[model samples]
Target: MFNLIKNEWIKIFSRPGTYVMIGLLVLLVIGAGSVMKFAGVSQEPEGDWKQQTQMQIESDKQYLEEMGGSENFQTQYYKQQVAINEYRLANDIEPASGESIWSFVNFNSNFVEIIGLFAIIVAAGIVASEFTWGTIKLLLIRPISRTKILLSKYITVLLFGITLLLTLFLLSTLVGAIFFGGGDGQPHLVYIDGAVEEQNMVFYLIKTYLLKSISITMMATMAFMISAVFRSSSLAIGISLFLLFMGGTATQFISMKYDWAKYSLFANTDLTIYTGAMQPLVDDMTLGFSVTMLIIYFVIFHLLAFIVFKKRDVAA
Candidate 1:
């Protein structure tokens, strides 16, 4: 299996599109950083832009106490007061400001949308590339099992996800160093109470990207399975891409209107969203829980890919 994996690696690396995707990811990270760098948008690392505002609120309340409640602004506290209550209800932890880059890139991740979109491209490209150049026959004729071939392809595709993310992180760090200047790698999630919860940005970024990678892996597995079943890589990719976007909307709708959303693969689309937009998890649902679901989904698709590929006839 290892050798099979290696052989799959060679074939995958040999493709030009693989490197192209890596290059694109490099550009994306650099581009985003460049935008941040050039725009003069230094976000408060304490999560959310209004860390100072939260601080001010605390100060105001303290002042009010000292003044014997002589002055009070209902407007200021009322707006955030409900949010505070909900934060406490949803998470035992007090609502923090967010992250160092919340103001700039907090909602930008939309992991499900990003990873789902990425998966379609990578997944379709995996088998589409083989069939595009008419080399799929050579692929199947090898001594390796068809199931192993698909697994190898899946691995190679996943490596692409890792490489792309690594490039983005490295480029971001470099850009941040060169353009934004060096800052602490430690990421802190600030609460509404003005207390900061520290998270290693590097580690958090790694874990977040891995979650994204897993999402992409599920996508790749699904696409590969489609390719095996359809035997038309282009059709497989096209179909998968179509389904990705559609599944996202459909799944969200189902989650809202029906009670079966949790059962759907698309239901667990966004890891960030699953964590309540990084708000925090109070119930059984968590980033870890979402990842487990993803793993189960990946395994199911993986098995299906192997089963179909092993049994399918080669027509091309």
Candidate 2:
């Protein structure tokens, strides 16, 4: 199994395209850091930070009161803002004096979608390309069982996905530090149970990263299943990318009128709601419920992939 995984891993990195993808991602992070550095120096003089924070807090309070009766997502957003601002005011945690490394790293979280796109491309192609390139027969004729072969490929793709994520994190942090000093420890303020709480910034960032990556996992799994069943990398990649862009929006629209939308794969894929990023689409939705739904979908995806692969006939 280890050797198979290693071989698969080697195959992935053996391609110059993989290196190009990684390089492009790094360049993207650096470009974002440069833009952030020059965008706004926050010319607010040092002495007025407290006053500024206090004013922001009061404004948020007003907004919160105004939004008190609205049960939509925007209300939850305002509530979260109110909680965080109040916490910052209470804790005397002024905003960063400038764009620090921590701020840059935090800002880079928005780019996780790019990482997911790379992962989806890899996952979408990894299995189907074997057939596309006419290497399936050679791969299966090895003494390895078909199940182990598929598992190795899946593991390899997942490892590749994780590698891309970590690359983004590490490169963003290093580049951010180079551009913005590292003196400030990025701290996060979270709203919980009608109150704002201070949490380890690193922990929050890592949690955010993992939660956001779940969509990649689901899309990759879908692509892998499509590849195994259809033996077409382009088809798998097209559908996966289309869903990646439109799935969340479609899910939101579905959730507006349908209670069953809570069971949707996209709805559960975004685990950030559990971390209070927003209110659940269904008031009854909980972390456990979403996890269970995801697990069911995950099992179904793998079952389709493996069953199709195990029975698939390769023309010599």
* Top model number, lDDT: 2
In model 2, the Cα lDDT at residue 223 comes to 87
State, as a TM-score between 0 and 1, how close model 1 is to the true structure. 0.69
Best by TM-score: 2
lDDT string for model 1 (62-94, tens) is 655566743223333443443454444444434
Residue-by-residue lDDT tens digits, candidate 2, 154-181: 9988898888889888988899878887
User: Model 2 TM-score?
Assistant: 0.93
Alpha-carbon local distance difference test for all models: 0.58, 0.84
Alpha carbon lDDT at 217, candidate 2: 87
Per-residue lDDT, model 1, residue 130, is 68
